[model samples]
Target chain A: MALPDQITFASSPALSRNVVDALRAMIASGAVGEGEHLKESELADALGVSRGPIREAFQQLENEGFIELRRHRGAFVTTLRRRDIEEVYSLRIALEQLAMERAATRITPAILARMNEVLDAMQHVSPDAPASEAVALDLDFHDLVYEAADHDRLMRSWRYIRSQVSFFLQVRNRSHPDFVSVGYAEHRQIRDVLVAGDPGRRPTRSSTTSGDALPAPRRSRERPGLIAASGRRDPA
Target chain B: MALPDQITFASSPALSRNVVDALRAMIASGAVGEGEHLKESELADALGVSRGPIREAFQQLENEGFIELRRHRGAFVTTLRRRDIEEVYSLRIALEQLAMERAATRITPAILARMNEVLDAMQHVSPDAPASEAVALDLDFHDLVYEAADHDRLMRSWRYIRSQVSFFLQVRNRSHPDFVSVGYAEHRQIRDVLVAGDPGRRPTRSSTTSGDALPAPRRSRERPGLIAASGRRDPA
Candidate 1:
């Protein structure tokens, strides 16, 4: 049977959303360098869209902490300094701890079942897959934990920080071995703690250092190499 | 001794910082409403600046999550929903817990002395003083606690959430008398707990349904009224 035209159509047109998605991908892909200017005409031309929608997309992106807009100068990608990175990860730890504790009480059987599926997938994926795949799976596992916490605001904040850190994670994953194994073990421990249904489980002060304690990369001038490795043309 | 001209004169003009500050005030002051268009030309005219500086300011603001830019459409003030409020507060709870727990070990004598002063001030504030003054002092007290936690990242995240909630607190404070008193007492208790120097002291699980439970205000059509109450605003 042929479907009605209304049934076949999506509720909203994709132009605005597509622009947002494209811009986000560009930023996330590291095509846009930190503090690089965003020329409206060039971006609009590249995206094959009028300046109006592109401007709107920029506003949305700004709210999401992806880009910075200047009054008259123009927009630019943000630079996350060591201090900024530290602040973000610290917040993440605090929020993750809260989510773990809340999941102890709020995690349902269904949520746990879905989490188990993700864990199984992680275990089964060939280690030969590009490291990015493992990174994505790691993000998915954390996202599931946030979902189980059932706090909408925490989830949004988490998304903001996650986006900011995604590039850093890419660099870190490339440099670190056993990153996946260590992260997976932590996830399993978190899940076990949640399943124990003890909301009182406070995060022990094991190490104040960041995951694996790799020193933060020094600011680099090898823009071309970084851009190529990160798979994005420099927005600058 | 008289200061030298070099010392007295501004060595470096802080145009970018000033612009960021001005734009933040406009947003925080309700001079700009959520979802209202932040036309670059209009803002430039209002701030007595060229489009160049305004563009820079927008970039900074975007990084701070204060405004959203749409392609061609222009930037708009962010409109946070009820769910955003809830998520922010939940994150706040987690961050506060982390800060409080760590503060137990890291609270310096200076910090402790400052806290004692603030608590003493809170106890003796004339009921006749403007509510704004009281609120400002209260915020300062909390800020001190955050500092004592010695985690810059956690404090930064907390600052962002607190700014978002400031608008709501203004309204909440007007109707709730015990809000100030109860909060004062809680602050005292938290201080005492930290003073015990036990980093392992878990936050008591107070009943969630008590009178102290945060009041969930109904969404209203009125513009946020307390935007201008504080001159210091940090977007993130």
Candidate 2:
């Protein structure tokens, strides 16, 4: 059976991988709340697959740190902590900063156009739109940078943490209703920096603007400042 | 049944993850040569597990880029190319360099001692010892850095690319027989720098020394210089 349109899994004949993608999206989008128990039968029913693929996906998800499988108790969504946010952001900053550096040097006119296209799409998103919309466009902008960098393994590493980043962005979207406009300005600054073509000038651009690591829960305001200067803008 | 002692999996009760470790070890160690077909039944028999776990492991391995699942043709180990070496090394340098930087700042005396212990163990290995010996200690040295970084997601990113790095290091071990001793010196330099307590000074230390990456198979000689100053060593 074909995976539904909304499930953006890379096309593969392996039912389990598709199931992994579907379930991962559900978890990342918060359709399945953190710490919520996952029942194989229920997931199977929702995804229109069998328990076999669901079980297989559980193993992969456990390995990916997306969920925890308790012995005999089944799977539970891994709860995000302040540390998880900090860890993800710190690594994302390192990787994305490197990518931006490389992308700045190697970026082509076509890639810039594509990035502008994504930014234009971001311009259309409503401040009160679903978090997924803002999150999707935000990731697309970074994805273009990774693409321009053209380092296969580097992009692979970005993918490893992307879903988690998406989850955080979702939180940022809800927490900051003005994220659409604020995020737009931040992304435009990044694009303008790239267009300026001085990779060496702002080598630590992302991390510098991101402030220190997301040190505590109260400091969650500073978490999604990877590209956005959201830390300076009060959510309240 | 318990996984064998040689299998250093993280003591998970999940049989499939154990199988992933076993199969991953085989491929990374070159026991299952690149492009070799993996028979589920044969692997199941060899590992004394059911075909169920073998099948499940194949899915996970494919996701990890260790093997390719050809529709109806079973699974085959991913063939490493010069591009693979470059891609892996580029990202590894970015991630490991960041790890080393963070580790230098936040590292404890105990972690430094543990790193010293691994270096001492590497010192004892014969220059012509099995590639696996050199690879394990090489990874252990970097693993200590990731552990010292103490960022959960950063370490997770390290593990994501680790097996592939191991595979490349295995290639380095076989291609450069003197890798054991040379690798020891390189690791020692890194340790000394970390011990010097100046993360800010040598921020680009690893990449500056790794050269322009393993650009071609002819340049395979320069591939594993991630830590090793093999670029200047002259393999011939």
Candidate 3:
């Protein structure tokens, strides 16, 4: 099978980052199976780099929860066995909601235009096209919202959170190409909210609870906020 | 000034983790100034350990965004400046709200009681108590919910998000002892919500926006949720 596209290894300066991305892309594309033990020497030989960069890449991946390093034992790709996809979806909602809120407060016409630009780009990436295109647009659309929020720590935190889903999303999209269109509609919904402008200054009915931004998840099929249907937990 | 207590150095076994906590405590206590370069060798000597552990500890801190590793230069503690506390508060709202929601669904009586146990322990930790006591309880209260949520990645991501506020929280408590009370009350509010149980299953007004669970930031002062006022942005 062909390697997953659009995950071109980044060049120079940060050599370990390239290895990290390449390895992550491999994991995403199912080039490497889950629960596989990743030997440093094997990866070093495969990537044709020294073990130092391989070790560093392993360190970076371990930090991101992509891999685990046991004492004396080498690194192994992390298994998300007990952690259900539902929890991941919920986190995406929480984080993206915060990002949307901040983006609403800080977003300008130019930024809104940029999101629409991505949306326009999304239309051209047909469902029959490579899932990477879908993944890239999906990542870009959500990323712009966080980027517009202008919070360094939030953005940094999102990057780590996104890593967990990057491969999973590609797999999901590849299998269900419908996610491309479905996800675009979700992105448009977010765009509509931001286009409505800063809700931070708008007065709303007072409530004493947190999560005031989201109504309770009354019905499961298609919750209204933050790409809900994209990842609803099928009744377990 | 005496190093603000509660940050004792840990002995071997997990030396790097111990170093991470000790260094974090130092940062929290202002022993290490923000933007100061941290020499691994100096830190090794000072902590009575070798450079290997110090390097590993520094890597950990850098991953948490506490320190920056320059290309040629060594590590520097990141200045939380330019980082608006308002953004930080909102992030806490997003993360903790989701954690609270999940914890509510699966929280055993055992965990709830454990939180109450911490709360009970907290009272003896008077406002007059070392700010560290308040800090520890504050950390414990929020941490239990994430832990109870039982999602490893969520918990891991929260830990990283938390490092940004930890030093700020300790310093905030040191200076504003009143926040200790303010924060406790807020934690109690969340406890009440969880005790009420199943807000996720409960019906509420439906909304399309991402933050439908959260009401608009009507006032900058305390609003309901997890500890609100403790981290409220000072009107600069």
lDDT of 1 by residue, A166-203 (tens): 65577667767567676556566666877888745665
lDDT of all predictions, in order shown? 0.65, 0.71, 0.65
The TM-score of predicted model 3 comes to: 0.77
Q: In candidate 3, what are the lDDT values of residues B100-184, reduced to their tens digit? A: 6677777888888999988887666676777777767877877888888777667877787576656556655554667656655
The candidate scoring highest on lDDT is 2
Docking class of 1: acceptable
Name model 3 segments beyond 4 Å from true: A1-11, A198-236, B1-10, B48-51, B180-185, B199-236
Q: Which CAPRI category fits model 3?
A: acceptable
What DockQ does model 2 achieve?
0.51
**lDDT, residue B92, model 2:** 73
Candidate 3 lDDT, A25-126, residue by residue in tens: 776656775567888777776777777777778878887767777766778766553233455556766676667667787887787888899989887777
Candidate 2 residue pairs in backbone clash? none
DockQ score for candidate 3: 0.44
lDDT of 3 at A158: 76
lDDT of 2 at A1: 22
